[model samples]
Target: MSLYETVREELLRRVRNGTYACDTLLPSVATLSEEFGVSPITVKRALRDLRAAGVLVTIRGKGAYVKKQVRILRQLDMRMHSLHGTDISLISVTREKISDPSMVSLAPPDQMMLCVRKVISSDGAPFLYDASYLSSNVEDEIVDEFGRNFIVDALRKREIRIVKTEIVVEAFPATGKAAEIFDVPNGFPMLRRNYKMVTTDANITIYGVVQAPFDRLACSIDFPTLAMEI
Candidate 1:
């Protein structure tokens, strides 16, 4: 691994293990450089990367701090992976009118969709709430699989391939049902990911919205992989 990345991983490990307590300031760049036997520039780069990774929060004129509620973002590549971790709990599946603006393009405005609701949890505590709005035509194929795996797998079962995708991410305050599910107070910051996928079958499009409390979800990208492609 690169020197800065090695330092970043080590720092992340410390944060996870409580060596650096939540909301507590980390060692100064100079101190870390001296301890790790790396240059100050290298330490600075590591800190910057950690901040971007959502493991640390840096304040101007001060050093970085371990985020009070840190999220270990899952890494994803070109392939769509299981959104939340492996632990999943099926909530409910029902037919509902397509009303969310993010999903309007997936079906006709007047059409009803099969909504699959599920929660992603860790050790029985739920972190992510996923609502997949599928084209009503594939009810039997997807209903059984979405509870155990992502929608992509169900689509593959029907010989369907996703040819294109668009994702929009935004942060909003939790309210009502959202707050109750995440066990957070109303107005707590939350992350929302709106997904739209187009499959080889023109009539079929997959649209989903995944929501999680801000501290419970994050996303990360490996720069080396992208750099290699270029």
Candidate 2:
């Protein structure tokens, strides 16, 4: 790796591991340069990239420090149709069952269980990795027809409507297993989401974990609240 990238990785590692707690001022450029055996210019470049990515903030007189964590916003809205109202084709599902034996569970016969593993990419780069589970026993036919984009529309076609959803978020260190799938260095920090998708007849709990490079992930949420009376 290039010197700048090495420095960037080190900085991110320290932040994620709590070596440099959030909002804590990092060492001066001179100190980092000496520690990394790189010129101050290279260290500055690395810091610049981190700042641009919203991972770090630089004070005019006090050196740079890590930024506070950003909250991830989850929004659920109706999918729009085209003017012609043509529906998009379902994602092709594969007949092959989940190869990961660790995911299998022995639930009661009445409960439906499904596991989905998807590698999410952005602009051609593999940026996000997700593994989700649904309680509704998806038919083999449905699995064979829709792959990654299978849930929302397939439920509609099956006459099962989702009435509500509950979402929870947390932060955790990436385990070795997760690091392998995410293709990132071990011990990275990631955002974990647990979702309960409720329908008229059943409730399916889905676990969605998003793992990405620290510099590449940004979470934002916007909502309105009622005005308070004086």
Candidate 3:
């Protein structure tokens, strides 16, 4: 393997084995270079690559640190008719909650109440708390089909397709149960996501809330901005 790859793999192994826990600062570039018997540039490159891959994060003027564990973000492309175009959908749900349940009132509720909560971990370290709620009126069987797999996969089996979604992201101080689930001190910042999924025919809505360590979640949007005439 390439030198950078070798270093990255070792780093990742350390992360997985708890040598470097979440949000833990890493050694200096020079220190790593000396220990790994490589030039500082090689270590820098490896660190850069890992940061870009979401395995590490560099805070300006603060140095590099381990990023919180993240799950594979299932891509929700707006242009795609369905996740796999087979009438199935896939959504991620975790077992974390916000400081306030009133935040859910931001949207109108629909029929049916299918909700699932799960705790997500990285290398066995708890990192994410997610809860997903779906309208219960669509079909009882459809709700029952939400098996142990991804929620979208279950929705697909019922012939319900997610044609569109709206996401709202905000940062807030952790409180009450939210703080405990995230394993953060009181007032520590956490990311709260309010997501809504819409189907093609049933006008159904699926809402979800995800609470996770601020360092663990990263979001990026790629859309062309309108250009103005000079």
Candidate 4:
């Protein structure tokens, strides 16, 4: 690889891993040239590459600074937009009996369960993929008109208010299934969130997870705080 490509890869790694904090100026071209043992021209070219990638911003007389984190959700909150969207891309649906030991007790014995796996897209590009489970197979619910949040929608219909929620968010390389669904190369980095919904009666009403390509979603402030977006 060329010297600038080598430097760019390392710098990209630093920015991604938070070694170079967001909104902070990167090392000067002179300093980077010395560290990478390359000419200043090469370092400038590498920084320019990052700028084109939306990872860096160059200001006159101020060098380059990591771009401030931006929210990609626009006006819609994730929970509402992901489910109540007019632009959903359905992938597949499966119906099965409740078998998970922990979740079996959430509903009556022998309750038929439904699983909906879908993708959320923008400008024709898929960005989020999710697999949601519901306590019953409301076949008609698949219609966009009836399709709201599979979990919360069902609960709300019964006036079951979620009293408490438990959410776990983390980053992991995309699984084979997710990589294909997201149209990303294998093992691409992704953000995942697993959550449990509890009703006012203190019952765990639903459990499911959502995954999104890390690049499409700008993590909220505090770098890792982006994990809370789910």
Give TM per candidate: 0.61, 0.49, 0.52, 0.52
User: Which stretches of model 4 miss by more than 4 angstroms?
Assistant: 1-79, 82-86, 96-112, 136-150, 200-204, 218-230
**Which pairs clash in model 1?**
none
lDDT of each: 0.79, 0.60, 0.67, 0.67
lDDT of candidate 2 over 111-169, digit per residue (tens): 43465656555444444555555554655665543343546666677777777666555
Per-residue alpha-carbon lDDT of candidate 4 for residues 1-230, written as tens digits (9 for 90 to 100)? 98889999999999999999999988899999999999999999998778756577788798999976543543222455453333666677667665544343334346566666777776666767766665564446443422344556655666668776666667777668888786555556677766666677443355656788677764342343455535
Model 1 regions lying over 4 Å from their true place:
1-68, 76-85, 101-109, 221-230
71-170 per-residue lDDT for model 1 (tens digits): 6476544444544344778889988976766545444346787889888886566778999877787758558897777777777878889899877778
Instruction: At residue 94, give the lDDT of candidate 3.
Output: 28
Cα distance off (Å), candidate 1, residue 195: 0.6
lDDT of 3 by residue, 1-230 (tens): 99999998998899889998999999999999999999999999998777645577787688888876544343334332332322322343323333336345547463446666656555455555667776554565654455354567676776778888788788787787876775555566677777778886565667777677666655555556977567
Those runs of model 3 whose alpha carbons end farther than 4 Å from true positions after fitting are 1-106, 110-112, 144-147, 225-230
Instruction: After superposing candidate 2 on the true structure, give the runs of residues whose Cα lies further than 4 Å from its correct spot.
Output: 1-112, 203-213, 226-230
**Better candidate number, 1 or 3, judged by lDDT:** 1
Task: Tell me how candidate 3 scores on lDDT.
Answer: 0.67
Q: Which is superior by TM-score, 1 or 3? A: 1
